[model samples]
Target chain A: MPETKSQSFDESQSAPMHKALQREIQLARNIQMKLLNGEKPELPTGEVSGISIPARLIGGDYFDFYPLGDGRIRILIGDVMGKGIPAAMLMILTRGAFRSAAGAAQGPGQTLTMMNDAIYKDLRKLGSFVTIFCADWEPATGTFVYANAGHSMPIVVRSDVGTVTLPVLKGVMIGGLPGQIYKEKTSHIQRDDLVFLYTDGIVEAQNAQGEMFKLDRLSGILVEQSRQTAEAIQNAVVEKVNEFTKGLPQKDDITMVILKADGDQRGV
Target chain B: MFKYELIDEEATTVISFEGDLDIDATELMEEEIAPKLYDCSNIKIDFSKVQFVDSSGIGLLITLIHHLRERGIRVRIFHVSDEVRIVFEMLQLPDIMGADVLPEFEHS
Candidate 1:
């Protein structure tokens, strides 16, 4: 009798709590979207665009552009461990660390080192980690310097070469270990070459048949759309993923950042 | 969407994981598998049946190994499929979790 009474009482108490929770989650989604969709920096020699689609109402994927003056923009893309509200909170933490680190760090590698130093203890305490790729793109000089911390390598699509194979550069995921020094690599972005940075969700997105979209399919689309604008290419990839999944709900967050070198080189 | 089997061989316990090791497996790993393995002296993880692992899955795997290793337990992972192995290699799990933990497969 007591158990039945408790069940009835709990049913009465749960509805309002559930409604309030849903409302709060929606509000949180709004805040996250606003932060993620902040103004794109105006680049003179190339155009850059980014987008994120959470597996849930909110997600852990993050991308940001920080203009460092003189036509150079610091671009960062990261995938926090896990999904949903917990991951979203950590993503905000990651964004804060990057903003603070980018202000003083000279290059991508240094920024990563500072970020790791800032967040390693907290991440270890929480039993989590983040995979990130940071890069400084100077549009005026077409210099693309980047560093990776256990994130997927960006796919480069050159008009003449198709998919360009990059040298293997990897580091332990942020928070995996303390005192990590991420090494930097440099590549010149020739005119019309496209650099695609992404989270694993895109390649791992599964269809109803359980077939993944994989890197090969993504690379083919990038190569075919190499001539498109950054925004267009981003849209094309998203469209293809949607088509591939056929409305099956994704289990992980999908995110991508695109950088396309323009034909004319000038500082804005 | 993950399941596991435990086989006791002398003093060593071998655990084989099957299905996608993603967010949904968190509860099972934390509440069931981890608790069962904490007291073991030696453990071997079989990743041959594991087809996919996401960021969240990676976190779970690392946490499980770290906890076991902290207790001075010997852990080794073998029979990882090429796909799953690539993900582990990308994260450089060999370096962080001890190279001996995830050793190269020996062809017999």
Candidate 2:
């Protein structure tokens, strides 16, 4: 408890400044939500949707869908290290990097490489890292390619094979090293298959009994609801987690993005 | 939650930690380590009792490592448990820190 000049500043002397700080954080949250939730990218032959629920008033989980101009769409989701304000600040920094990288990179692997190169120094200097999963989808060709950076794999719910975690792509987390190269894998989706992407927050959410809603449980839920629309499946998974936690306070953010092959043609 | 004991062994300083090395507990370690570092050249961290660590904890360690390196202080880590090693290896701590912490790999 040694009083550093900033940490031990007089609280009473900065009442207005405190309020201003709170408002600024609120604005930051607003900006994050606006950017993450803006502009749904509809596939000509499929559908995609995403949502993020921060554990705190503001959180660090981020998800976005950017439609590529060439009949393909790019989706990105990530969890920054830590939570709340510090994590949120890094989340924005990651977002800027992702936006810039996605626009210029030719593939998901290249996007991660660019993003890591852009922010690795800063993140390592800050002593934190981010796990990210990025993928590109082409409805016309049924081609899906993805790359991961120490991220939890997405669930691939095949119409025939039930729900399975996406194959893990071997790559280190962003900021783990300099001059890192990321590789991607490609897969084809059937007409009724679904791909679910998420951050670790969802599976790590703990219940009052200290039991976690782990990966198996999440996969089970996806298996049961494989036929549902992207949004309905998303909400159902959220509902399941809510029931399991049963109103307990959580320490991590939860985020999910779902894509169903030929989903726009099917009604929710 | 964690506890630490600073034991001076000959010319080397050993900081043995028990319990979780986490973000919330970082300040506690910082309060102690910051003051004693200048008087020491070689530092050893004992993680035998550490049950968990998060990114912020790792970050704190990396920052401390950089600071020590800048000041010409050397650091070594030992007794890493499987739980902690998973994180250490995932972040490629061995390559980054220039340390030999993961001398042996154990799976639990």
Candidate 3:
């Protein structure tokens, strides 16, 4: 008999294989959920929270917070190419590279460079890539320094300035090239200002009519909910996307992180 | 959905694409592209009529490119419009496609 893809999933051949496959998928999902939703580190000058919702039983979107031990919080968020199993598996590979790079690298730019170097071969081998926005929130200085890897810029809600703006940062996506260096950008995070990071799935979410949620709607919600705490802002964005989607099938994984500056800045 | 045509030249193969390359079109894309993609030395993919490509569509492109390159097949992309260029830029397609991909640009 010639081998075929249908043979493994053929119901007539084996019931035990189906049960085994289901159990393994569930186990994989549990592992991914726990690793992705780890505790956010405490910050002296700001507050931060994040959430990830998978379109399938497992997703490719990823976000994590790590303390640099120097009054700064390192946060990384990204979207892996494709969805479901292939993407989820690469997400784990990316996670490992990020954690390893963040430890030895001095800044976000260097961290991305290190990560790209570590994972470029593997991503190329698998015919996939990841887009990451790596940032270090310097709470004492109220500065948000970030590096981009082909990910779209995150919205910055300036409460004191009363404006919503995107920070300037440009770089090729990770695994785009073997030895590409990413560019880092900076913004002064005023007290009460909010920095929002996310994957593309949020903005690309679609409605029943095929209209996408889009960046304009997300910006509006963030600016309107800027005064709220990090948790509230995150919830509001998710709610807005949900409302726009209206029970439409989710096309990809959604993940986001919001960092809100603490203390008072009545007169900026 | 995308409709592709495979034109066999004496030395090169041209796979021309027309239409959107969303998730729903991957299987169709695979069925069309796979047979022609094998054992070609020079491949040119024309994206002039391609409108949009989502992440899943990008996966197909990447996987195809990887396969082609492993066989040492030279690939060329031509007539990529501004909209499709954005998606290519996001995924950094030019890097894999090489620099001489008919002047595709990244939107600022």
Candidate 4:
């Protein structure tokens, strides 16, 4: 096979095109990181923090905090199906829906309902779905109200009780069906209690041996780190996950949010 | 990595999969697996050897099932292990993909 003029010409143009694409992907990853690590609401009585680590250059996992007018902070965490650039695009869409719905909705359940209505058609058309866990935390009153959209349940940790089991609540994932009304569940948050919300990526992370960092291991770590600050606990979990995975490349985005009641009240 | 064996018969098509289903299966699912099922009237997916399925896998699985159903193919899944079944239950796959498609099977 001999190289023709067309082949020579095509080879001449491929390098810069590849370089330009790489630059664009790097910029996209920076934008995603900034949005995901955006401002956290200043709570009067507790602390909240979140982090996201994409498995690829850019990822689909998302988490945000919106301060409500009534002193409660609206928290959203979700994992969009698939990964990389396509998932990252849908994550931005999900963030927009959550932000718009957070201000207008009265509770976590309503927020999810509105979000579903906003993005359901688009998701269906794309053949993708997102599992989300949304919650409204009132620092002064210690009221924790949350709703689920086919996402993992948040683990509640109390120093005296260990990992508190939450009652099961079910709802279809966004785009799973139309006209979905996600039901809400309420729980009391005492002072010093920590709520651990995460995507499946955390537990599903695998090591070189093909072993997963299961829920039991995560819960044990949480129980041991219950005495630390919200940020410390978050870091501890990440460190343990890194140790468990032993530097293996992850296949999914790892993300989590920590909300802890700090015991000083300014509003109810 | 994912691998599958397709067994097509006169009235039914059975596909057995082995290995963890994840993002790696995207191309194979769309280009290879789905095209094979287009002409089948009935399809059954065997999950006996599958041990893990992540979110990406779920997405591919959803697309496959919906694609088949939209074409009037009757699809059902059986032999899912308890661990993978728990993941499916958490995501409410039974409801989203039709409960009949994901029937109960005894865990060995």
DockQ-based CAPRI category assigned to the predicted complex of candidate 2: acceptable
Quote the lDDT for B77 in model 4. 95
Q: All candidates' lDDT scores?
A: 0.92, 0.82, 0.81, 0.90
> lDDT of model 1 at residue B47?
90
- Candidate 4 C-alpha error for residue A130, in Å: 0.4
TM-score of each: 0.95, 0.84, 0.87, 0.95
**Residue by residue across A68-169, what tens digits does model 1's lDDT show?**
986799999999999999999999999999999999999999999999999999999999999999999987787889999999989999887899966768
Could you report the DockQ of all the candidates, in the order they appear? 0.87, 0.38, 0.51, 0.80
User: Local error of candidate 3 at A48, Å?
Assistant: 0.8
Best by lDDT: 1
The parts of candidate 1 lying over 4 Å away from their true place are A1-9, A263-268, B105-108
User: Taking the tens digit of each residue's C-alpha lDDT, what string does model 3 give over A1-268?
Assistant: 5456676558565778788888999999999999998887877767888999888889999998879998988899999988888889999999999999998988899999999999999887777788899998887788788898888778887864655666566687888778988778887887777788888788888798878788788887887888887887788888888888987888788999988887332322
Please give the fraction of native interface contacts (Cα pairs under 8 Å between A and B) kept by each candidate.
0.91, 0.38, 0.53, 0.82
Best prediction by DockQ: 1
Instruction: Report the TM-score of candidate 2, chain A only.
Output: 0.91
lDDT of predicted model 2: 0.82
Query: Candidate 4: lDDT of A234?
Result: 91
**Candidate with the larger TM-score of 2 and 3:** 3
Model 4 alpha-carbon miss at residue A76, Å: 0.8
